[model samples]
Target: MTRSTITGTAPPEAGATDPGRTTAAVPRTGRLTPWLVLALVVLAGSAVLALTIGPANITAAEVLGSTRYHVLTWLAEHGLGFLDPGENPLSRIRDAIVWEGRAPRLFTAAAVGAGLALSGAVMQAITRNPLADPYLLGVSSGAALGAVAVLLLGFTLALPLAAFIGALAALGATLALAGIGGRLTPSRTILAGIAVAQGASALVSFAIVASAQGDSYREIINWLLGSVAGASWSSVAIAVGALVLIGTVLLASARTLDAFTFGDTAAASLGVHVTRTRWLLLTITALLVGAMVAVSGSIGFIGLVVPHVVRLLLGARHARLLPVAALVGAVFLLWADTGARTFFAPSEVPVGILTAAIGAPVFAWLLLRTRGQS
Candidate 1:
């Protein structure tokens, strides 16, 4: 184990993962070809279904038509065969629904999932906590309290801002509580997050109970539980920006993050600024989570589960696990959201509920495995 120099902060710089071995000499971790091909096809297929499948009842063929037309139109070709502008009512509405309405939401789901999962992986490494997750750390709950209050008070204009404020404040509180003398420990950090979650939950209850508009509470609660139902380009822009910023920062510190897993004292011995890096990284992650929760609501389990799954597959290396976890998170949430919206047809369940249902069983199985190993 050697201390590596931290380079200029941006997307990660590719370096030789195995220092002693050249590329040709390095052994393949496993057969990634099949999985890589599968992931590509799934992503592409998911995009098609995400664009086409919704409450709108548009067919995949119409989605292909509109998408093909866009590509061919760019090439000055006329063979895409998109229906005429006013020839059919179904095609017109179908194009609008798929291209305009659903695509952005689905893209947001993928991006948000990746962002949350990436952040979670970093946090788990930084804190050395298997249970670390964005939503579980009170970031989502704090954002929900702020966003929910804004909704109930007819301050839709300020909802995102309010959510950001709550998220930052919550992070501040968590850090303050976690600090001892001047530094934080992983256990303290986890405890503070749990306390903040409880506090935010109480605040949410009060806000809902005191709302003047009783009718809006159900819809507001649904949003708190998380949904990408009304996601649009404007909000997706914010999510995408958060994803890029946080993903870059975390990946930049991947080696340092891996060091933290060996314990803070051990990491510090390796020339990593154990305390300062943890503070900066955790705050950055909280900011990212807060921003995500504002738009997508409190989509849970993604932050906790995706990283663990990736670690299990990749053998605890942050470099490989981080990117793969991001992809898995994206794919998992996109499909989870799809199931929530489509499983019951005319009625859509909150995706959060679906995530919880799927995550809980998997979580139990994981716990059982851990116990068995112990």
Candidate 2:
């Protein structure tokens, strides 16, 4: 398909005059400012619903109360005790709704959603291909090897750690494959991604088949299907750490990614060191995906769908697209998770299954739209 050339708007120069504040040091009103605000509201509402609307039927009020109490207690314990709230019924309910059950799951879902969406956006830019996603490009499979190995061997404690290593390894293999004949081109890079994904898939299958015994086989399948069930405080900690670390890194590199959206030659001419930037971006994305996949298994489509939605609304500027995409992604996953937890009641479906189900029709529509445009 022939893509529409993004034109008219000049890329915002870093450190330029702030158009919004009417000062030289101020930042301009990004073109998608209003849409971004709307996305934020959607995200907030979705998060609230995810936290409160389980089969257990916790209300939004209960969810908020619990979260607030926990935060205040944490603040007090950390020497910010002045922020503590007094005794209240809401606080008690909040304790039940937020701490024991929904908080960790909600956070994990948000983190995984944001991470996948962010990584997908970066990968699409890196490859100059709209079809790119962390999962589709083999980054998730790389992470999955570590996770799958964990399921196969019944490994505890170091599952996330192993997944991180596996992801880096898979990415390294993809890069090595791409650079086989010297320079890394888009076609070569995508081909390498395909090869790595297939290889990872083979290993995962072998692991599953080898452990086809009574216990591990079902565990393997469940793990592959992806779930946010059984999340705990430790998992939340890992996910939060991953989000803060990788989100910061990627946000810092927003300009570089934006440069990449214009294609490699243009990015290079605009002072982006294409090779180094791509390498670093890939590594960062792999790490983010690994951490998220480790916590949430392999929830799909939020990455692929959210960024495109953001692009449609925000016109493909990475600066605007990045945060907005993250928010929209978090919203999508939050609601999807709520559905997964509740739709079948006692029998929970994997969040990944729910996302794929939703994404299929969206994917079809997008393909049709692209074809018509072409």
Candidate 3:
């Protein structure tokens, strides 16, 4: 293939007949803004509605009230008593359920969703691989290994720390392997990641089979399957912090990602430092994914499916694609987790299972659609 074909762009002399050939074409920002606003509104409404869901009998009004009550209480405690809304309206149980249980879990879900989706979008663009997700680098398996090891060792408190460390280690290893023979290319990176993932999976299986017992076994299973059922304020803080800080960097690289879709040589010709940019973006994505997986284990599909769905609606330009994808992803996972919380009633299903169940069919549909379009 010529450079034009490889880069998905046609030379002027070749004729501009294939309008859809170029991947870097920017769409009108005005057309995309409404989608962004609608996604934001939907995400906010979904979060509140999700809070009101579950076995607990709570309403949207009550959820809002609880949120207001907490804000006021915090303000009062911080010596801004004048801003306090007097009197606690809800009973202790309701407050605890909303504040202590559901609120953190819901926020964590949203944050993780946003982060994963952002990571997946960047990954797909950077590698020019549509099937890539946050876990394509073996980060998720490594995290599971660390978390599982801790659970078996009776160090459940250190699960998040261990998981994050393991994810970083896996990232390091994958990069090292990918760079060993020559310049790190997308295909090499992917192969190395698969190798690391398989090795980590093997270790995790052995550890679980040999050591896990009783509640530890169940805990290991739950975590591996991914759940925010035990999410606390701390989980919310980590997930949201990672999303905001790292996510900003990723979003800022929108134009860089757009250039990437045009192939390395094309991007280089456009004055992008392809190797440096790829390394930087990949490392940043791993850190964000690590923080997310540490808190929520390996929640799948939000990363894989959200971007494709958003791209179908908004097109492939990264500027329009990134933020809107985050919002839609937040809403998607928020509801998936809500279903996980309520669908089985008293026995909560793992959110990961729900995402996979939902993601598989959606992904297949996306593949068929893409094929038809092509």
Candidate 4:
């Protein structure tokens, strides 16, 4: 079928910003700006609510008041003394809970969610696979192995750095395996990733068995299951930094990604450097996923589910889809992590478990719906 037929719309106008692009058709009754604004507002509200709903029993008013006071204090410290009104409404403990504990975790959630969703969307587009996820490249498994190794071996290197290295190593292995005979086909890439992920996971299990002792198993298992409870300002920095650095490049390459919807041959015909672009986008995605996994472990399904939901609402234009998916993913995960922490009260569940529980059902429904349509 032609690109237009597949997209269910004609190609964009020649003089349009995205000329010749095939954006998925959705109803044109509503403007994108309003939806985007709504998503942003929801995300902001979710972050605040997540901050308030932790085990401390803090009120929304208290959270807001504390946030305001800190903002004013920071401004005052930075030569904008006029911004300070000299009122401290929150106690030190409350401030610590908000600023040091919940706030960093929430920020990390937003960054990780955004990065994973964007990475998944790009992966699906480039590979033309509905089931593609950030972990499809074995990055998450690789990261888990790295963290387990560090824990077992008592390595002085930070867990995040080690996990990032492991993720890169897995990506290298995947690429090498997939590109063995000729061009990297999607089937070959997926199979290679599966192999790498299984190998890395086995290695992680071996490391745990050999070195993990008593409570070490608890720590290793928790990290593997993925929790944001341990998030700190450093984790926030790593997640946000990776999102900004790599996410920007991915967003800038939206046109290239959109072109890939029509396959590599069509993308090449449209002046896209198909091979180089694929490599560059995949590498950037791997880096983003690795950094996030380093901070939060391998939280699943944000990447797999968020983009598809966003596409349903906003259509398949990467220009619109990428940002919207990021925002929606941020909101979804902020709430999901909040549930993980608060749902079981004093005993916290891993955020990854919650996502999988939620995502697996949703994925099944999506699969059935797609099959019905076909």
Candidate 5:
């Protein structure tokens, strides 16, 4: 075949009359749309199931009733109601469990999952490394250190702010270390991040050992292990707000991320401001990771594994990959968190532990597959 036929770019003589031929070279949207729809459906169902699967044993009907009651109540309070305030079918306790307890936790899980997955995908792209994740820059470890300090010092109210500061500090330090020679290469960045992560982790351990006592130690350990157990509406607000804002920015920059796939020079040739874009994206990612860790602790592997799984199914085009990965991550973590809480009954496993248990094997398989391909 001629080059024109192989690449689907027609010769100059044929281009004027056969413009439709170029369409064949594009990735098929039909093949991807169904998967995206399926992911959304699964996420919706998972959210419902997660809301019902806690220790309370609330049925689907009660969950639905509670949600409807709260919506109507809010509407009535805001003078937009078409229903009576007294029409709630769920009892007060069940309503509270569904609305106050499970709902916030599930929402926080979904937001954190989506944010982490998106951040991972972007990091992998920007760094040109398949194994890169949100924590590759030490954001999680730094956030953990800040969170541990807050728990130790009894400044729980400032946990989120402290974590954010810690994450930014770690990022700054990583960048400074990586840019020692006035150039930021992926290898240098990764090495610097590892150093930062180790240092932050040590600080966390020392803080815990020095200050934690009894329940404080347990709480610190639980937070380090990652759980959404104490999630409140306020936690939901923080997570969802960060996910909506930073996640939207990341998703909108999908084309720019795609540019980075071809390396800095090529992306610059394509009119992408490589350094500025990279810095902006990295800072945004740090913010998302910090916010998530602040709310849900350092949940592991959702970021690392979700994007790889999605990429295996959807290919590596960022536009399609980002949204689908976000949905899949949300669904995956919702179930994982649910299993963490209910799998062993009364005693709870950390959600991070469950993710690591599942992710480690999946990661091993992926590594083997990648090696075989190589």
Candidate 6:
């Protein structure tokens, strides 16, 4: 299939404002702008709303007040003490609830969600396969294996570092296997990743079954299921740092991704250096995924679902799809995580469980819709 066949828009002329934007498809920018604005507004509102939730009855006013006071204090500590915003605006308990309890987790969720969704969109484009996602390369399973090893062995090592190392190792193995016979095609990459994932998952299961004990067992289980309840200021730093650093590169490659939509041959013809671009993008994506899974263990479906939903509404233009999908994914997971913590009152379920439950039915609907189109 060609670019026109898949996107229903012809290739661009050399001097087009965006090489990915064809004149025939340019009109949707007007429609896409409002959705982008709405997604930004909703994401901001959701972040504030998430802070006010939980067993505590903190109001939005308290959330905002605590946020302002802390922001000023942070600035003062960084050599701007002249700009002090007075004494603590709220009681220490209330400030702790906003700053220590919910704020970091909220930022972590948004960062991880945005990273995963952006990676998924890029993966799908590079592979020219709608089923590709952040985990399609075995990063999650590898991270889980590493985390389980740390927990079961009673190691004092940092869990995120171990998980990140495992994810990189898995990516290396998958790429090596995919390149064994000849060129690294998407089909070969996918199959190699599946094999690696299964191997890592088996090891993780064995470690849990054979060595897990008491509290460690529960800790392993929670990490595998994904929860941001343990998120701290460090978690926010790690997650947001990775998102800003790698996610920017992915976003800047939007036109390249658009070139990739048709296939390697089409992309190469359009001056995209298909082979090099594919490998580089895959490696970059793996790094981003590794970082996210290290912080929030193997959260699923936001990547798979959000990009497609955005494309359905905003067209397949990568420039629009990537950012909008990021914002929407952040909002989606924020609410989902909030519900996971609050829905059962005293008992806190894993956020991954909630995501899978919601994502499964939505995925089924998307699948059926695709089949019907065929």
Q: Local distance difference test, per candidate?
A: 0.77, 0.75, 0.87, 0.85, 0.84, 0.85
User: Per-residue lDDT for 231-348 in model 2, tens only?
Assistant: 7777888887887898888877777887876788899999998888887777778778878877777777777877887776566767777877887787778778878888998788
Model 6 Cα displacement at 30 (Å)? 1.4
The Cα error of candidate 2 at residue 151, in Å, is 2.2
TM-score of each: 0.83, 0.86, 0.91, 0.91, 0.89, 0.91
Q: 1-374, model 4: which lDDT tens digit per residue?
A: 01111332434552367534533344523456667788889988888878888666888888888788888888888888776556666688878888987899999988988988999999999889988999998999999988987888888788899999989999999999999988887788889999999999999988988889888788888889888888999999999999988888887887788898888899999999887788778888998999999999999988999999888776787877888888888887888888988899889999999999999898888788778766
Instruction: Pull out the clashing pairs in model 6.
Output: none
Tell me how far the alpha carbon of residue 333 in candidate 6 is from the true structure, in angstroms, after superposition.
Answer: 0.9
| lDDT of candidate 1 over 302-326, digit per residue (tens) | 8888888777665576766676777
Candidate 3 local Cα displacement, residue 31, angstroms: 3.2
TM-score of 2: 0.86
Please say which candidate is ahead in lDDT: 1 or 3.
3
Count of backbone clashes for each model?
A: 0, 2, 0, 0, 0, 0
Candidate 3 per-residue lDDT, tens place, 108-171, comes to 9999899999999999998899999999999999999889878886665678899999899999
lDDT of 5 by residue, 23-100 (tens): 333342335566777888888878877787866678777777767777888998899989876566667887787888
For candidate 3, the TM-score is 0.91
lDDT of 3: 0.87
Worst 10 residues of 3 by lDDT: 1-10
Question: Which candidate would rank higher by TM-score, 1 or 4?
Answer: 4
User: Could you give candidate 6's per-residue lDDT for residues 212-293 as a string of tens digits?
Assistant: 9899899889999988878999999999999999988997898899997788888989999887888999999999999999
Model 1 vs. true fold: TM: 0.83
Pairs clashing within candidate 5: none
